[model samples]
Target: MSTFQTPQYTIVELLNKAQCGELQLPDFQRPYRWDDERIRSLLVTILRGHPMGVIMTLKTGGHNVRFKPRPITGIGHEGLKEPELLLLDGQQRTTSMVQALTGDGVVDTEDARHHKLRRRYFVDVVKALGDVREQEDAVVSLPDSGIVTGNIGRDVVLDVTTEEKQHAAGLMPATVLFDSARCFAWMMGYQQGAPERMAVTQQFLSTVAQSVQTYKVPAIELDKDISKDAVATVFEKVNTGGLRLDVFELLTATFAGDGAYFKETGEDFRLAEDWARTEEVLHKHPVLKEMRSTDFLMAVSVLITLSKRRTALAAGKTGKQVPQTSARREDILSMSLDDYRTWAPQLRDALPRVARHLRDLHIHESRGIPYSSQVVSLMIVTTLLGERAEEHAVRARLNQWFWCGVLGELYGSTITTQLAKDAEQLPDWSLAKSSTTPEAIIRASFAESRLGSLRSRQSAAYKGVYALIMAQQTPVKDWMLDQKLDFQSYDELQVDIHHVFPKKWCEDNAIEYWRRESIINKTPLAKKTNIRLRGDSPAVYIDRLDAKGLSAEQVDAQIATHAIDPAFLRAGDFDGYFQDRRRRLVDLIESAMGKSVVRDWNVDSESTDAPANFNEPAASTGGVSIGGEPTPDRTL
Candidate 1:
């Protein structure tokens, strides 16, 4: 069946329906924003009998698509009920027409600067009758008071406040154009007062006023059987000048229109209020704040799909007859309120658990999260597992899948597909219900050369390596503060990623730029500790630490916690330190991914062709260097 029908309605019919509450705007439609000039131009277009554009609407009685209905702005008829048709597009144009052409001719609109204005429209009958081309200039907008003033209201330039004054000034109120009785009465008054201009007034009434009364606006009425997603999609396509409505906005209107929910609960369902409360809960856990409303809705969709699949299987449906689990956009759009109710609390509870799991991996904050997208899958899989997610063996498997996704960079794109797969597979795989490895783990691969290009903390792999280093069997510690790199100290000490081998020292020694800036050469350190490094060589820094009353052995032990070779750092051997640390990092990644990394020992030599600057002067700064820029002592 065709989804819509193109029907034409006269301007009189559209306005009458709107005033009587038969035609209304959907809640998803944005408020009217047409300025005074635009409204005047629209009046001119109607007077000229020109095609403004098509208006799109949806039949409102359907069980499938329901949006809360609101009267067009400036409409205040008592007991306004549910509309028969919900205006989807042409809201601005239709609203401007309704306000200007009906209900006392007063329009609540804005000026060019978006200043609020209450205005009444009029047609200068003299100018309108003069020339056909001058019809547009005939429309005029005045303040609601129907008086024009100059010099800050001290001078009254024009006053059409009464019917006699309007007739004398040759101004025809636009509000009377749609009402034949009012239009005829205004014409009789104008003709009786000025017998000499009777021919011009009759011509103006027969032409401009007649055109407005008979104007036919094209409308596309969507069938009541169309789906909610289709309505949202169609609204977006037609309303291109407006903001695009997302799934949450669509659901907000859908839930608000749910009469069944209102019957049961005796109150409206507000998705935004619920989300705001959920957001408050999320803010309590810093890492979980990364989960957005869309992500939460996607998780709910996945659980609902999985629930349907389970029910179908239990009813003996098999193979092609069974529903496929999905978290795709279509599935999210089709999800019901009951489905959300069934899983929302569990998913909300599961996110905090996800945050705890991240903390266990030494990822204490949102910045440390490698892939925020991965959190949705984790929320779903963890919720499905429940208490078992806290079990040692199950957590180990879950950790492996997560690290594989991060190091492999698989969650950067096509995330919804991956989210569905992990939602369906990870729970079974982690709990030993199936022995097959998840695709994320199977497809995961880390090449040795990526480490050279992993220079910025922006890379997921770079952040992953940092977390893994701190999460090692022996916890990494601050070199100066000697505190374990756990969640408490991580924030309390203001730890940040800093260079292990000072950038200035590396540059002075003519090291390759890529090697000098690589993740392998950086580790998280306390702000105080980084400042004390003072752009000095590792050999010089260690001696300074030893002078602070720390034994060499204790200092070396702290360095070892970060997967570094203490002897190489103490000896200031850049080559040995770089090679040894790279291997150690690869080992940590391998353990986390539960897979072997492809080895490329020669990657350092082949990665870059930029020559070392052996002739550049070695500039010194009193403060530590960060990212190769020197800072003075006070600046630290």
Candidate 2:
């Protein structure tokens, strides 16, 4: 017999098999991570005749191992049976279809704390028509707009058009399209009085169903002789999008076969459960909540390998210490179940300490965290040095390094190689005998051009600037509210990062949009202040504030605290203002660093380069330190 069969299946047929328990997901597949935008995009791709790649499945009895099978979610459960086929790849696209078609959410297998998934997807037939012509159009599961995903149900109208005549074409629930009887009934109810309208709706629905029923997905089935490792290799190679699977995910599936691997504990060890617990631990940390499972796994790799190496060194089994590198793909792929199990606790203990260390450096939240790869280095250094890692001297160097990494944009691009090199220095930094400073490495990587060219809110340097603003204890007061500004309470009230000179004023004066949008012109202001300053020049607003009984000194002090040059406010000297402010800001940065490290922009604006000693250590201002005792169990 041929080892396997390659056959095509329609969307309806796949959903039926899944609902009937014949088609199921493999136990090791990652949880559904598709947001509404992705789901909507998939529908658009399908409707427009785009080739979404084929899904791969394995014959259940063909493999040597009796793998545990899971019924596809979003459809109501049928009695569990031996699954005939197991989905090996395309979980993301497949899960999206199930959710869109059935309006059922798959339980998030990754999040143990919250084992629920609820999302409502819809499709705007009116909108989909413009993009998809009837010459080659089909029905989509959901509408293109107003997609809302969460635990709670939100009532949404699918149609977004505003004309009075299009009222009948309002949002249609995409889930009804999966059922012919329901769809027909809905059409009958919708077009009861108008036969012509009914005919049109019927034609549209029929075309959609026909398209889905005839759409073919190409496939390749593995022969029965294929080994489990081969399945993993093929799975990774086939899913080139990198959205569905990773080393940790593959390992999670690989370890699933090693049932009762922990012989001594009497408790069966499952990689998926352990992975979720690790995520839960990271989620509980105030600074680490923004961390992804992939990031946590990288740290876990360090915790496992480094500790083992340390033990080997202590035993004199190894002649000399080797510099540790960042976690590699091969290291994760070849990880043993036992090693993975032990590393979970170490990660739970070590990573929060890394967060606390970062928090002390005035990185209040994840957005303030310049590069998460810095966590890997922090984990290794703290784990090696123990309590002394949190010493004032040690933290100051780390703080300086953190800023340098941000300003230098060290981890912005080419992250993996840079992380490997940075990780090599941890051993030296951990030892008191060595004179290695992380700041030196950061300085070598630093470039003055990055700081001068910063304009976008998305750039790493922009976040670093915000962190620096908070670090210097700049008095960011809310004059309108008569209260001290608490930057941390950003979630409670919207903090507007508005232009110092109103955009309308800039447009009126025909100023370049890029100059108006520069980081130099951006500052956090209250929504009220932003709205009230509409189209007003800086000079005009300052005068208005003065008219409201605020003295000139008070206005100047507030603006100065925000790093603005008060002299530039005279007649709105935009060019001179930017130059002066940039100079003073660079000065403040050097003063904060306790050295004249940063160079100001020359008049030419093209050659804003730094001094020759850009890599030298700035004079220390007794080092950056903060409150908070280094305790082992810090929770969110």
Q: Which of the numbered candidates is closest to the native, going by highest lDDT?
A: 1
Off by over 4 Å in 2: 1-25, 30-232, 240-243, 260-262, 265-267, 275-287, 312-324, 350-368, 375-389, 427-433, 439-452, 473-493, 546-551, 591-600, 605-636
Candidate 1 residue-wise lDDT, 1-636, digit = tens: 799999999999998889888899877566788899999998888877789999998898898988888899879859776699988888888898888888788888889998999999998888776566788688999999999999998999999999999998888888887777788788888899568978976786787678777889999999988997787678668768777777787888888888989999998788888888778878988877655677778788889999898899999999988887877767887888888878988887787788789999988887678776677788889899998999999999999998999899777555677877897789999999998889989999997667766776756778888888888989899998789989888889999899989999988999887788888899989999999997888989989877777799999999999999899988989989998998999999999898899886573463332333212324434322111222222110
Clashes of 1: 0
Clashes of each: 0, 8
Worst 10 residues of 1 by lDDT: 627-636
TM-score of every prediction relative to native: 0.88, 0.59
